[model samples]
Target: MHCLEVNDLVHRYRNGDVVLDGVTLRIPAGSIYGFLGPNGAGKTTTLRLILGLIALQHGAISIFGLQLAAHRIDILRRVGSLIESPSLYDHLTATENLALLQAVHRVDEAKIGDVLDLVGLAGTHRKKVGEFSLGMKQRLAIAVALLHEPELLILDEPTNGLDPNGIVEMRALLTRLNRERGLTIVISSHLLAEIERLATHVGIIHRGRVLFEGTLDELQRRRRTHVALATNDDERAIALLARQSIAATIADGRIVMPAMPNTAIAQVNRRLVDAGLDVHELHTAGDDLEAIFMNLVSN
Candidate 1:
């Protein structure tokens, strides 16, 4: 069974501003699913609905094959979440904060250290949470959520305040959790590059609606092929690509062609050579999530 499922889900504010419109999704167990969208795209609202933090206006949601509403307490116990931001008592030490949550959830004290170690905050447990860096706090929040050894983890904008190194650390920690503990993760982020690096599957939402959902390969396939080319004479390469009816643009001192099939690339190279242009370099650009995202939302 899928670890989480949503069918025709809908939600709206009290003023009747629809936030999510008939969305459906399925996340298999132990996969990292990236939820991508701009601000006010209803990504957070959808997560809130799935986590039962907000009332569902329509449709169905199930976690671990159990109806969310029917088994709210039971499902939540096995689910860990770090929503928009971490919440912790400023005056309390990290360990103390975790202990408080443990007392509330009735989780074992032994699990506190285990989770802290898992998130790389083992030695800093005695430090006041207020004194922790943004990355440390984020990791601590994750450690708190993981204290109960949840099977599923949901994080909304997990890298918001993180620096480059912190983001890398968080990614590593998440990768480890998925690999070692077999945990399923649902994460939302505005950072497309980060999503591309981490997610096994992705769902892109815009204007309270999902525009695309699929594996990275499928997403890449949907994107137009873009090739970055450099010849002995840049202008010659551009002219040659243009003659072949390839949409070419100059970027970073190279001629760029929107995604094209491999055969088309060879054709471009042959055309360039025939045109007396020495092909210095010719390679397809990586499928850019930012470009794909901009294209989807612009429409």
Candidate 2:
């Protein structure tokens, strides 16, 4: 079942700036859905609408099988979020900061320690939040969101400005959170590499429109894989491949051909050898995801 659904979302500001234009999304339960786009592509706007930070100008939103507009209070109770930055007191320790929010959330104070451990900040003791690294602060903010134990997690550019180690830490933390808590995570980022590493499902948005929405595997299948081979008789190889219905070309002295199954590749090798052609090298060059993403947004 889908944990969140947005249909034909069109939000225009009073100044006539439409940040979301007929946006639609369906995030499956227990999947880490990556909301991907260039900066200013309406990722933040969509998140804000889902969180009720802004009134919806048009369309519909549903979370956990309930319409968001009609069940805002109830739906929000089951969603946690860290948007843009963490709100932390420079002078207060991690424990102190969570303690402050705990009062409003009204959960047992004992959960403070639990959340800190979950975020791997339990050893901070009384160290001020100001002393924590950016990654630590991000985790703390996530701990804040987790304080209420929401069933879904939404984060906007959580890995932005994080170092490599910090990125890895955040990925592992998010994966563990999803695995252990059964949390449906929706994260937005312009960094393709980050999204590629963490997301189970992907949504590519551009200029306020979702260009693509599907599982990561579905998108990966779109990658263009080609078999490249180095043959002694390039002319004969091309003819042999064409006769076999395998598109082939000689580029930079290598016979490049369209993607084929392993059995087909083997057959091609055998046929080439039988035709008195020496096949030197055979391999597949997988498409780069950045290229695929560029093609999508450009078209």
Candidate 3:
């Protein structure tokens, strides 16, 4: 089942600036969906619309088979969100902060301990939130979100200000939450490399539209590998490759062609040699998620 679905979503600010334009997305249940885009690409706007933090202007949003318009409160009850940053009372102890959320949400106080441990912040219960590290505070925020036992968690740039170690810890924690608790998470960030490590599915948004949405494998498959070969006679090498129906282009003073198997590459090398074109260097290079993201946004 799809955990969330948004179709033809269009959102504009009161100032008349269109931020989300016909954005559509489908996130399957039990999957980690990475919502990726550059700054000002409307990623946060879409998340807010989904969570009912903002009124829906021109689109349909469905979560867990319920229409968001008619079931705003009911749907929101099943979702936990941390947008941009987690809101916390710095003066309060970790446990005290959670106690406040428990009272507001009316969640069982017993859940506090469980969530703190789940987020690796159990030992910090006596510590004031103001004294906690940024990473610890982030974890505490996640604990607050989980206090209600929501099935879906939406985080916007959860690792925005973390050090390298903090990033890794957050990634591991999210993965564990998905695996152990069966939570469906939709995380948004512009960091392609980070998402590449954690997401099973991805949606690339740019200028308020989704440019690509598919499994990580699908995105990787779309990125073609190419053989970069340096030859003494570029034109001659191109002609020789064309005679064999292989397309080639000259880039950075080297001949580049679609990647083939090792045997095929060897045959090309031999053909170039036989045609009197001296092959100097040859290697295979493939585009990564960062390259794919750049290409999509640039277009």
Clashing pairs in 2: none
TM-score of each: 0.87, 0.85, 0.89
Q: Quick one: best TM-score, which candidate?
A: 3
Clashes of each: 5, 0, 0
Model 1: colliding residue pairs: 224-259, 225-258, 225-259, 225-260, 226-259
Tens-place lDDT per residue, model 2, 1-299, is 99999999998988999889999999999999999999999999999999999899899999999999899989988888999888789799999999998897789999999999988999999899999989899989999989989899999999877899989989999999899889999999999999999999999999999999999888888898899999887888898889988888887778889888999889999999999989899988877878778888998
Off by over 4 Å in 3: 230-254, 260-264, 271-281
Ranking by TM-score: 3, 1, 2
Cα error of candidate 3 at position 177, Å: 0.8
How accurate locally, in lDDT, is each candidate?
Answer: 0.88, 0.92, 0.92
Off by over 4 Å in 2: 13-15, 230-255, 260-280
TM-score-superior candidate, 1 or 2 = 1
Worst 10 residues of 2 by lDDT: 284-293
Candidate 3 per-residue C-alpha lDDT over 1-299 given as tens digits, one digit per residue, 9 for 90 to 100? 89999999999888999999999999999999999999999999999889888989999999999999999999888898899887899999889999998997898888999889888888985779999988888989989888998999999999988999999989999999899989999999999999999999999999999999999999998786899999888888888889899999998788889989999999998888888888899889888889888988998
For candidate 1, the 10 contiguous residues with the lowest summed lDDT are 235-244
Candidate 1 Cα errors over 4 Å, as ranges: 226-287
lDDT of 1: 0.88
